[model samples]
Target: MTTADTPPRTLPSTSDNQLLADAGEGTRVEFRGLVKDYGTTRVLHGLDLDIAPGEFVSLLGPSGCGKTTALRVLAGLEAATEGSVRLGDVDVSRVPTNRRDIGMVFQSYSLFPHLRVLDNVSFGLRRRGMRKKDAARRATDALDLVGLDHLAERFPHQLSGGQQQRVALARALVTEPRVLLLDEPLSALDAKVRVQLRDEIRRIQLRLGITTVFVTHDQEEALAVSDRIAVMERGRIEQVGTPEDLYLRPASATVAAFVGVSSVVPGLAAGDRVEVWGRSLPLHTPGLNGDVEVFLRPENVLLVAPDGPSGIDATVQESTFMGNFRRTLVRTADGALVRVQHAASDHLEYAEGVRIELAVVPVAARARTATA
Candidate 1:
């Protein structure tokens, strides 16, 4: 509910700024051999990463990929069974959660119902022995960072779900944490609000230049806000890179399959090229191969006239109308299903049972070495 029409608010008070400076302008994070075991089940396998100061890194993967466990270890909430967590070069593997200078916000808005928004934010400062008046002023300024200063006097019950989460953010930041940990903080909000709040969180993090570690299973969300993304799987990091790196130049078959809509087309491997759909496109396979599989994105498949060009013959099965692009499903002559995407304004007029030829873009594509 925070609107742009609201008056522009200045930064927090000098006292809070001093506290942040003392904590440093974001701290570097190093996870050396980070491992976690719940009894006999090892969730993390020697995870290693070096997060630069003030960088926004997202731990992204499927549900049980140990991203959450890694975040917990960094926050000192959970100890690593084997490995060390280094924050700004100090080994804090054995440090307790309370003694660590990190702020965390979870999926649930853990707001105090008994206190007002300002008081909730200032609670940590007040507990640390700041005067009543100073804590209130600092809390107000923190709320202003998240655009919740107008609601400082309101209670948790009076705020919307998004507002309540903003209050939680203000509370975490009011103490000037060395690092901010977010565990799927926007998961509970509606789709629209989730997008809005995630954008705001990214804006605030960049504005403060604070080190942040975000854990999320949502791929789009990770791609949207992260400076880099660590794609994890089976207790280890598969690859770590920017969003474009992960999508365009996947390191392995697993990465190519997991990151986006990678559709495999039946093909024949001939040296460094693969003959897929009547086209000898550029392809690279590490080892010797005869029959192979080529992966192409939906948008990579082009639609041409069924008569003139000798492209792959397919029968249109389904067509979907997205806002900017149209998604159509087709089955090749050999009964292989392929999905194609084109601009919404100029897509193939292929309806159900309409025959068409799909031209595979002859760029660098990936192929499997062996036959299935």
Candidate 2:
């Protein structure tokens, strides 16, 4: 079985291990009314988010959404045009990046090409005026935490992309910063390596209990590892919630479309329910009573007999065989494309006529008159 198929390893409860014990408790991180601009263009628009101590929060959005700009402001890399960043109770908006007591890992593994892995990991500590012997010992512990102690003597070019990123991670943690910032650190690695390293990063974060802020455009990556996610669009946060909350109860149509796959079909809203494709389903949230657009998840759509008594008639357009499930796209009589997921065993060929039913689950929606 592949690593994805295997169950994740359970983390230990106690922090008696050397690396865990050294990490201590995390500090609170807050971004208050953060705003950023580049000369004439504004990138961040009065952004406000608060991350609790030791919680893993992901800033998830598409490109040009200002997620990276928010991170840079928090990191002291870019000055916020109009707000302050607080670590615990202290405002560090004016503090230099080096003095903020935070560790960061970037997309590119910015390791020293000439230095050995051990020296690369220990470089930050030595620069802080720590004795060489103590810095080396701490670096060894940090390397062991990421399971790369065996490659201490290798140079950057000698290691694989994943290993080099791990070295960067080790180097980031060696200083025991109060907060850990990850900026799409897994994007450069291959799919399998990305999964492995992301899982490893989550495991290490859990063990260390470090306050972490991860920025990623990959919804799956954010949903898989975050305690909470803040979805941003056009330099503004649309919603913030847990993975389940975001997926099941999106606040807006944009969130419904972004958090996961959703088919936007026209519907008529009554008191507490919406009628889509002749089927009445409960609304995820109340307060809509007019023509509306319903968001239907693939899993909520089911394929049934073509002659079924009550269902929408659609022609299969495409089918993709996932590991255990098959996702099929079908075009409805009204010319709307809908994606339906079903067991792999029940396959449908292209152009095959079929009837699709929406499961009686609460669905998110927005008024038809509302802006798209």
Candidate 3:
């Protein structure tokens, strides 16, 4: 009987191998109160993190937020001033970079120009004193895993940008490291290649079931590839959750503004009630009164008739067609600009001098105390 037609054998899925019921118990990586300091300036402030046996996590944040520093510590490239680093119940705080059993792929493709693709991938294995035949066999397997076996004989300069990156991935994975560290591996590629390779990398990582920590400043990439994301700010973790959770329910204003576009409008607040643009909303929280900021997302804003009596009067300031969506900039009576996104096929004709109305849904309104 054909494999598909026969009774299927139970094979492990990626989630089954990667996701743990109790993350702490099944965790393969842990950073306990980790800290990194540069001279007198402290970078990582008592950072704590945990990753299950094969979970794919992305350390997402702006530049200089200590995300990269933490990754370096995990890779044994940087020493933490305080706290401990453990891998699978073993402390590796003082381990050398090569002895840490971890693989790293940097944004720059650091392949050797004098070596062919096959030799480049086999370099790590050869350094470990593997026989030439055995090293070549392992190198071929890694190249096949990355779908670059056909390019084994090609030199680094003979390959395209995306191909070189794949070679780097193969080289890193050939070591059979337990933990994989990715430092903006796609940041150097063009937009089209970036999107294509993003999925390819995730696919290969899933197939291998290796625990990975990816560091990137791009929000879209983080949201697309990560199984879970840890958002960092000022050397501290702001929040950690699935992509949908962070987008739908942000814990603070910094998170809301950082992850997506938001319109902050002035409003009058009074004990769980706020009035913005002449519309009232229930704040539903305590310790918030007087003047407050109202956060409205673009997807939650709708356009209405220009002369509608109940809508806020706004003048169309500018509009741009973005292929899939149209971005319209509207100026309120107080000269505040609000960006609204509509589908490209939205048939609504608008001009720079035209008057329009802005409507906000009840669920999208949020009140926050002003931050200095």
Candidate 4:
């Protein structure tokens, strides 16, 4: 069995109250004609989306793309200038933030300084009028979920940044909110801790089966955790799909460049064939005759003997070995800079100013708009 299947001892029924499956077929969190404006600036432009119940979705984009605004609107923190927000069958456009029944974890650790870790986790339950003793019981369980129950007596100041963030997460989950909203919750941690906490957070979220919406500018984080990702640009959704679909078959060049490192070259499309440099290659796209740009990921390019038919004359400008892979920057005969990644094997070593060969088959080429 896969690791994702090994988490639960007893399989929970998808229809059971605990399982929290997608709200029926149409049961979803829907944004219908959503729009947000601040004076002269509009943040969301007629946005429409449906998030299935129990699904983990990430809104990924650069800053100023209105992803946060959309999250806030769903949280009832920001009023939509136009359109409605629906949570399952209920219209929550007019619901107050406290009545929305959603959990939120922010980049900033918002734990109260005077409260112990246990008290911080229990705060939301106490606010909802649970008995003090009962609230502590629920809080303790939540901390255990995050593997921080042993630190319950410590205050926020006594914990590291990652532990503090886990406390914040425990507090959010303790309320048993139907929907969870995470706003760059791992952005404050150092790089190594960020990856560790990221995995921990995913494990916990899936264990709970809560409908989650994550907003992030980090592409890796979005790709790592999301069941589906929505890429936003200029307050509009550019595309929405699984991470593999988005990475391997980006609908547009904007998405291709944004999701990962890419090397672009000019090409011409004739029928199903695309001509790049001096070669004609088959494409998945339809007929086109004008100029196009072909995007090739660094990992797809290989450096080999100059005499090979697929090889192009090149000179290595620089090289860096990153343990598992070697990154080489090569200048093609036409003076175009190309970055290639090679496996860290004995045969792949190259030094600065070394003449080399670059070869690529048509299958490795993907065309994007010249303008993108």
What is the lDDT of every predicted structure here?
0.85, 0.85, 0.82, 0.82
Better of 3 and 4 by TM-score: 4
- In angstroms, the error of model 3 at 47 is 0.7
Clashing pairs in 1: none
Candidates 1 and 3, the one with greater lDDT: 1
Which candidate wins on TM-score? 2
Residue 119 lDDT, candidate 3, scale 0-100? 100
lDDT of 4 by residue, 53-167 (tens): 8788999999999999999999999999999999989999999999989899999998899999999999988988999999997788778777688899999999999899989
Residues 10-51 of candidate 2: C-alpha lDDT, one tens digit per residue: 543344345677666789999889889999999999988999
lDDT value for model 1? 0.85
Ranking by TM-score: 2, 1, 4, 3
Q: How many pairs collide in each candidate, listed in order?
A: 0, 0, 0, 0
lDDT of 2 at 3: 44
Q: Once superposed on the true structure, which residue ranges of model 4 sit more than 4 Å away at CA?
A: 1-27, 284-288
lDDT score at residue 352, model 4, on the 0-100 scale: 85
